[model samples]
Target: MYLPSFTLDEKLAVITGATKGIGRAIGRAIALAFAVAGADVVLISRTESDLSKVKSEVESFGSKAYTICSDIKDYAYIINELDRLIGARPIHIWVNNAGINIRSEALNVTEAEWSEIIDVNMKCSFFLAQAAAKRMKESGTGKIINVSSVGGHVALRTGVVYAMTKSAIIQMTKNLALEWGKYGINVNAIGPWYFPTALTEELLKDDQYVQEILYRTSLKRIGKLEELAGTAVFLASDASNYITGQTLFVDGGMTIYGF
Candidate 1:
């Protein structure tokens, strides 16, 4: 009775971008983790084949996983489909993990690139959170986890637009948590530095870039997928019940470096 329970038993979770990179890792990890913890998961992604793969993995863990193959940018349809799929089940966890990056220099950033990143990263995330919040309010308890980045905290040379959206998410997480705390909704974010995901696969291949990354990271190594996923699980579980409106940086000390 003295120990706090971190079990997600009987809870339901929805994870966007559940097919690749950080999203896939987090989604699959969460799905499996949640399954072991006794929760059902809803995986949202754009590819049916990939969704099926993750679905199989989740089912292997003996938990039900429902897959939705749709672009998160089309959040309206996604939300509607979600309602139809779940049918009155209160969502206990919602992870906005779908995102894209155009990794261009500031001056070379095109309007199309800017719009695309903003739409998927910022716009889609907000509306989805809004729709999720409405449903969560009905149940009086829920957790909303936004997948932000270390780029949001410190300046990154990746691209201006991508950083802008991430920074905005951090702010959004705070404001939403403040507004929704009364309704028993906890809004939070996770910022990662470098992980071996498809998103960073190309960059990590560059020795110089890897060296630069290691120089900044106190841990001096790229993060493991499970490490990042563990952070998400903590935020989603009852362990973080009293925590909200904060971005947990899983950056291995990258944000703390200054010279």
Candidate 2:
């Protein structure tokens, strides 16, 4: 056949921060996409209620849905519980979509803020990926997707710590891809510019800020969740079987423009 298949049939996937903002959007989109492709999902979030809501939505697609209500920052607890929770099911895909950002000037950042952001964004991501890789190694095949940000590539006024972690993630993707390629694993990252999420809803309300953002973006519009989800699906499917160690920016041309 000339065309490659994007089907995720008979596979199982896991998504962290499966309940809010970008995480929720990507998680749900992936779950729905996987369902349509004939795969099941494991949704991870801090709130049981939110997990249940997404679980119901995923089940509507006629695929199995498992919910894990726990903090992603608690990587040890999560790594330990995953085996029990998943039982004999092998994870075919894992999305590190849980992230937090505190917008602040470099001069105003505090140690507590730095530590919290690092713990959640960087530390947990590494350990969790390590855990997921271990399970994926058994099957000798899997996809690991990291949710990075454009700030990781270009400097932004958002927060220095956040950028540092994202940059680390991009590098981490490359290193992991190199180390795991021999075992048939792929590691990649997605860097988004602006998407309408609870975190950015208020920020977008500022007309001047929106215009400033639009000025830098070639598309001159914020991204849709499905657009980002579509990218995730590509990376997760057989379409991306040969791709790894790359950060696909869903930034609407923001990275290429000059201020």
* lDDT score for candidate 1 against the true structure: 0.89
Compose the digit string of candidate 2's lDDT tens values, residues 16-125.
88887557666677677777777788888888888898899888988898888898887777776777788867999999988889888899999999998899889888
Give me candidate 2's TM-score against the actual structure: 0.96
- Candidate 2's C-alpha lDDT? 0.88
lDDT of 1 by residue, 1-259 (tens): 5655678888899999998755766666656777777778999998899899988988887878998889888888888888899999999999999888888998899999999999999999999999889989999999999999999999986678999999999999999999999999999999988887778888889999999999999999999877887888888889999999999999999999989
What is the clash count for each candidate, in the order shown?
0, 0
Where is the poorest 10-residue window by lDDT in model 1? 21-30
Model 1 CA lDDT for position 194? 88
State the weakest 10-residue window (summed lDDT) of model 2. 21-30
For every candidate in turn, the CA RMSD to the true structure comes to 1.2, 1.3
